[model samples]
Target: MSKVQKPEKSDKIDNIVGMLMEYEKMTVDLMRKATDTPILEQYDLNAPYAKARIIKEDGQIKYRIDEVTLTDEEKKKLKEIGELLIEELDVDIKRLGSNENAAAYIRKLVERIIKNYKIKLTTDSLDRLMYYVIRDFVHFDKIDPLMRDPWIEDISCNGFGIPIYIWHRKHESIPTNVIFQTAEELDKFTLKLAYMTGRAISIAQPVLDATLPDGSRVQMTYEKEVTRRGSTFTIRKFRERPLTCTDLIIYNTLSAEIAAWYWYVIEKQASVLVVGGTASGKTTTINTLAMFIKPNAKIVSIEDTSEIQLPHENWLSSVVRTGFGVSGSISEITLFDLLKNAMRQRPEYIIVGEVRGSEAYTLMQAIATGHGGLATLHADSAEAAIHRLESEPMNIPRPLIPTIDAIGVQTRVQVGEKSVRRMVNVAEVVGLDPTTKDVLTNDVFKWNPKNDTYVFYGRSYVLENIMKRHGYKHEEVMEELNNRRMVLEWMVRNNIRDFKDVVEVIRTYYVNPQQLLERVKREKMEAPSGGSRPA
Candidate 1:
């Protein structure tokens, strides 16, 4: 039989190619016809891999994510091939660097497997198969589309069997069509999340608080250990491009006047504490206001989980590190530790993402030492914020309270049928009363609920101090405020809402105010009447 010589290498390669070609032909022949699901709105989250649709079902609006659907035969093949691939494929995913690179690597391996096994699949089917594989291995699997949706601010899964709810930018909290059908499924997903964050989650240590690779804040509990239900998770998505001061003005979160006032105070290196309830946009306001800090000033930011984003080149960002092995271990780094280190760094500005525990005292000390402080507090009003600071945990002395220049009270309130965030009060910390020993604050701006407008009290102690320090007369300061207001309005009108663009404009004004102001005036004059204002 001539020893039944094994197929030559070239012949073997040709055989694989021929087999793939034949499989492609078979798949083309077996292709099945593939939604008029009442889509109110639809958009691609990740083109070709996933899409999101706002649909109405049984009189309820729901967010539905549509991904590639496979036939039963294809699904079975995918499972078999995936198991084999996982067992045999040797890849150092970390060495791949990015999701795109890892995806390409996975695709190559899947293709090699298909060729070796002579798996029957068309090009389109292979593409679909690769998407699921990459999604499960490199992304968040079923919720990957939700993770890609830019309009979603928060995603929460209370437990297995419960529909995932997303906090949509336009629709508020709405249920999505995705759910974890079994406790084991959610446990696996929770474990995957922990692994992604380079942490561990188990029945012994169930709680997990971590920042995702994309900077989104995530808190999870594993396998019904601490939570009453199954594994639970809440993700607060981070914006790639942070909101600018102009964005707040456009959202009516604060008036342009308030923004200009903040610009003036921030330029003067005044300490500000933004206080609000949950999801009231406190951190957002501080992050926006931080852009007004002089471009060259040395700044340090400390956070439990990184949320503050700035455009300053001379900025240092730090986040608390959870300890390994046990709580309060030496390896752990707390906000208090970071704040102390920030003081040693001699930063001109110290930004605390949120002042919750003992770190509040360190921040107060930094502010007292004349480091410009920016922070957020979970409180309803200026008084409440002061009380919290002076109480236990924070325990900031009354004398240190006045070291904070202003308290911006932000709140989310109902406007018509929708909830809107507004800076309800901008109070200047005048000082502690000699007799009463109470922290006195002058309300510079107060939001009027009736007309949905902000009323400036016509006088700001903070602005007055700024004027004195800068040697500006009252009239000159007022004129300067108007100029800044006009500049901000011009930016809003010109749609210069990008964080970096806003920073450039502010920096340009600092370098050459006349040049920028003249440009703004010229643009305003050249525009058609009423066209220079934002709609």
Candidate 2:
């Protein structure tokens, strides 16, 4: 029997390159198999170079040639090529726009370098070289594919040697295959992310909290001394377009009745406070509720980080700043400072994204002074929220609490195997109990956990307050509520849930309520039977 000879590395490379050289000419399934895995489908075929693909895997995860696992020697070569590209290529990165354009530019520069150096390689080797070059210089390296996956809501790495986990929109938290096994590799990647945020991280300032290039919130620990587990980072991905009232309606977060109640309350310039636990979608609920604000109202929003997005033309968004440099040359601007300054702006509506400290006191005072205020707080229930406010750090006077006309309690409930966020209660602040000195709230709407339905309790002091404030008759207020509910249903029926579309309809309603009502009625009458209605 003749002994079989194992193919050498050079021979394998030559064979792969020769095969690729004729790949374009052949007419077959364009599927390229490497090892045992295969590239199932290309995301962007028109791009100048290779794009990512949905690997032929069970979990529907993605893979890219640039992000594939490499051996130690291959990594060393990739590093050498990356260094050479940085030294020889003087391409202006600022001129680049999208990731595709940047990748194309880098590929062209690399091709020139290869020719100038008289480098001879197969097509497959050339592709491998380009992958590392683009990954290090043009893209976000290993995490690029994760960022491209639209279903991911968050990316979290506890420390080196641990697999990265992602919070997917549908599947919830899931452990990914990607990981950094060494502290040096993890530290370098963390610093790269920090620099991308336009910030610095070091032993002196061993913490970083900043927004990434794509507006994702990045919070990191720099060294092992601070974290005790090497470097760590968490990225809360940003939604390109925020959720709207119509979206909440479709998601069953809130009923059209609750949304319409908020609309009428906001139109009357009443204050509202949203309370929820961490990751309970408090900010999202409030952001959707802000859509109820009159389009022409002058609005000022203050936050530690910029999150709220409104379609109003007369809006000013302000973000707090942290001190910088050795001596802290740049003064740190606190949320309290922003709130106090926002009051002087004479805004018709004031929005505090999240109140954590004395800023809550300031927000409450603003509401008491009759500034149509809206804010979110970390609490589980309405009473818990009030207790937090009246407690230390956020010591709002008990009497002044009623200035917040309504409190919306958002909760994350476990339904079957999944967790979902729901607006459990929309309570109207009735008054302070004279005997007990506690807040008296009338629950206008409450979530029934048994049936997973939002039930109307009809306890609406908010309507009475609106009547007193707007001087509209009871029947007129009821009619307005019914009409607005119909409009919301009409929007859901027509799938008009885009932020801009929802804003346009609401603004048009403000301009001509009768016309808008007539149009909505006509559409509702023409809809298929068994559609959703106000709860």
Candidate 3:
């Protein structure tokens, strides 16, 4: 603690020490003179001091501290003091980051600055310091504007030197205006992310898929060998508020009539196959539509990534694991594997996230073998959706296609500068021709792009069978359907956005249509434009 007797040779140490203190923006030379002492043999080059802009804006370097020439005196003192500080805090850093490597390191950096100087890390840190000094620096903090952006559904980066891009719910995909200046910088940033997620991104593990603590999905490609351009990362963002059917209707993804009609299809125990091209919003539509199920019904949702968020109390959501515990663990369970497990769970409805391969056969067999099922697939149309399921790996039987009660196809379309997606087609799988092995389908509703709205009430052939099974006269069903439509319009007018209310109204109508219609007319009046009544 007393002046650690600085020898004449310590002058060189004091000079470097002054440079370290200056870089870190500290002013005291008394704390920096230990480097000039013969003890220099004990420590290597003073820990690289990530200091402020060495050369000021006006091109003046503060080479001297308090009128002391930087010759040998100030140099050794500054280097000695700075090394002790960095090395000591480096210990504090190791402790803080024992569990959270990168985050804890960042935290320790911030804490040390706050503890040593009166500087708050939010405004000061080596990370930010180096960001300005280092070439190709892009500030992508977790709390950046991109994370707060409501429209951004995903964030992706191929590597540094290229712009980062994001998929907006409204705009689809657009450049984020954030770019890394160099590949190395991008690689380091991605490494920080990997360490933060407690995953390794290296030559041994070239790929990483993990969720950020905030629930944002992140995928990374390790350096040079794994990805031609050093490193890469992508973030598939989750939404702030899960879109409900009404939200979809308000967004014009579907109309009230279409939503109400689908409610009928889903409520009546019909197997539904939602199909769309990649990123066309199929799973989302299925998630939204699933709100129609009876809350008491047992639903099992299976997926590789747990994306489907069903709010029903009786739902049991399951996700498949590549393997468990440790390395050498067999990659056993898959969507198909879960399907077999789902059957034994006594689920009234099996909701597969998507039928990419043979899982389609299980979904189809479930539908045909007296169990109602709901699933999504990557296909553009009803026929294509079926073909994808029936051909090759899936090889679902043509006859079983009819067992699929309906097909819902969603697609992305241009709506001005922004892109909007909607359920473009809904088809009812009516039957199969035994002689020709051909499947018959009826288009229930479709989006009429000319009108920019989905056409509903296109005579659901499946609804006819439902009516027959219920032993209701055809005339009664037509009246009931029309009456339910009026009630829905009234509910929409009355600001009844709750699907639960819709279920209630539908349930009442099912019990006694005439009474509910009379009661609604006597209570909730309808407006001419057919929108939900304003509160």
Task: Sort all candidates by lDDT, best to worst.
Answer: 1, 2, 3
Candidate 2 per-residue C-alpha lDDT over 1-535 given as tens digits, one digit per residue, 9 for 90 to 100: 9999999999999999989878854634334334346555446421444344545454455443334455666666667667778897675563676677888888888888777777666677777767767867776777767776766778899998887888766667767667889999999999889877777898888888888767788889986868988999998888898989988998889998888888988888889989998778888888898889998899999987677889988999998888888655479888999999998888989999888799887887788787898899998988888888889888888898888888999988987877888999988788988999778988999998888888998658988877887788999999889889988878888888888999999999999999999888787788778976433
Candidate whose TM-score is highest: 1
Each prediction's whole-model lDDT (CA)? 0.89, 0.81, 0.67
Alpha-carbon shift of residue 373 in model 1 (angstroms):
0.6
C-alpha RMSD of each candidate structure in angstroms:
11.6, 7.5, 15.1
Descending-TM-score candidate ranking: 1, 2, 3
The residue pairs in collision within model 1 are: none
How many residue-pair clashes does candidate 1 contain? 0
| Candidates 1 and 2, the one with greater lDDT | 1
Judge candidate 2 against the unseen true structure and give its global Cα lDDT, from 0 to 1. 0.81
Clashes of each: 0, 0, 25
Model 3 compared with the native: what TM-score? 0.70
The TM-score, computed over Cα atoms with residue i paired to residue i, of candidate 1 is 0.91
Lowest lDDT block of 10, candidate 1: 29-38
Residue 152 alpha-carbon offset, candidate 3, angstroms: 1.1
Cα TM-score per model: 0.91, 0.84, 0.70
Candidate 3 Cα misplacement greater than 4 A, ranges: 1-109, 116-143, 170-172, 192-201, 208-210, 324-331, 483-535
Say what the RMSD of model 1 is. 11.6
